[model samples]
Target: MSKVFLSAKLPAATTKILTDHGLTVSVYAGEGLISHAELLKSVVDVDYLITPLSTQVDAAVIDAAPKLKLIANFGAGFNNIDAAYAKTKGIQVTNTPAVSTNSVAEVTVGLMLALSHRIVEGDAQMRTSGFPGWAPLYFLGSEIAGKTLGIVGFGNIGREVARKARALAVNVQYWQPHRLTDPEERSLGVQYVEFADLVQTSDFISINAPQKPDNHHQFSAAVFKEMKATAFLINVGRGPIVDEAALLTALQQGVIGGAALDVYEHEPQVTAGLEKLNNVILTPHIGNATVEARAAMGTIVANNVVLLEQGHNAKFIVNA
Candidate 1:
């Protein structure tokens, strides 16, 4: 029987699937971030390894696992994994893409609506019993109907967001490295625009791009300045894509109306200044955190391991 090491706790269903295949599984005992020494000790003799986004799979770590054949990531983003280094050692990598698309897309739309309508402010005021009565001038906010939405990356999640936005009567535009043909544009009902044009003219801008060297700090002070004063920004992608200091300055200086973020540069340790600002909406990286999404991701990870153990190609192999 082959041995597998799981870095984090997964859904019971996923564990059952793997155990039913007659494979030995060992789960790490600790929660939160696992130490490097702990990982090095645990993965020494395992044939397969399953990990989450928080775990870093670097060259040294991969080299330590002499018997390792496959690595299965629980999330769509594989930035934490050093793919190039892993390839050198003939280790296969796989991620569950499009498994949590709807869940994340729903969160993106929710953030946009919350920022545009000031939903959080209203909720806070009501909790404090400060709401006097309904008045014509009370809590005026931006309307979502008939506004232009610009998506930074047009992948599965981005496309789903556009579908929902169109249902609410919003025009959709997108900017990506690879251009979409006219037929593809017609099918998605989205226009391919230049990066500068998307930044300048969009009423609401949502980022779904992956984190790469070329895209790091893609939205800085200069990009913020190009946007209209009434425009709003929402990010459900990697945090470092937007410069934290620059975003803070933009919010304080009113470069744009407001901002919403589901991910941050230094996660779980937001800057003090960001906490003090009332114009921004923040969440604790819960875009694909729904119960359903987590279960689906776990199942995908388990299946990937099973396939490799059975001498078959994994369904979502990254290296292939």
Candidate 2:
């Protein structure tokens, strides 16, 4: 029988899918995340390993699992797995990419609105100091309508962001390594622009790109300096894409009017002073935390594992 190991416990229904296919499934039932030592010990006899996006399945882990045939990742992003090494070892890697796109896109737009309108700040004031009543120019905030929104890394989430932002009368422009065709651009109601122009001209900026070695810290001090002083930045991408220290400085000095981030350069350990800043809105990386998204991701994970066991090519293979 093909034995499968889960680094963390998933929905029972998901595990049942594997069992129905005649595969043995093992789940890590610990409260917190599984440690590196625990992971190394668990995968010894498993044919398939399912892990969270944050768990690191490095070359060392790969070498330890001689029977491992597949790494079925539970998240859209698969950066945690050493896919290239897995490929060399004749192992397949798969990610659930499509499941979380809408959930993340919705959070991206929600962050934009919260940041521009100071929603969090107002709520805090109403709870603590109490509202001083409405008056002209009292607790002023900007409207997203008629504003230029520049999107960095135009992929699934970025395109979705453009579609939603356009509904609010916001002009959307995007920049990526490959520019979309003219028809594609017009149909989406978005324009393709050079990266430099996008940063300088946009009233709001959203970073929706994946994390890559070449693109790490892409938004540094220099890029922040080029942005409009009244502009806002929204990052739902990987944490390391933006330099948190540099971002902290920018927020402190008003380099770019304000910012909202769902992910940080050092996740769970945000740079000092960011939490104290009222100009920035910070979230605990819940971009894909919706109940619907998680359920879909679980289904994809089970489906991929079942496919591989059935001698069929799995869907959403990252390391083909």
Q: Whose lDDT is greatest here?
A: 2
Top candidate when judged by TM-score against the true structure: 2
- Looking at model 2, report the run of 10 residues with the lowest lDDT sum: 262-271
Candidate 1 similarity to native, TM-score: 0.96
Clashing pairs in 1: none
lDDT of 1 by residue, 169-239 (tens): 88999999998889988998999999999999999999998888999999999999999998989999989
Off by over 4 Å in 2: none
Model 1 stretches with alpha carbons more than 4 Å out = none
| lDDT of all predictions | 0.90, 0.91
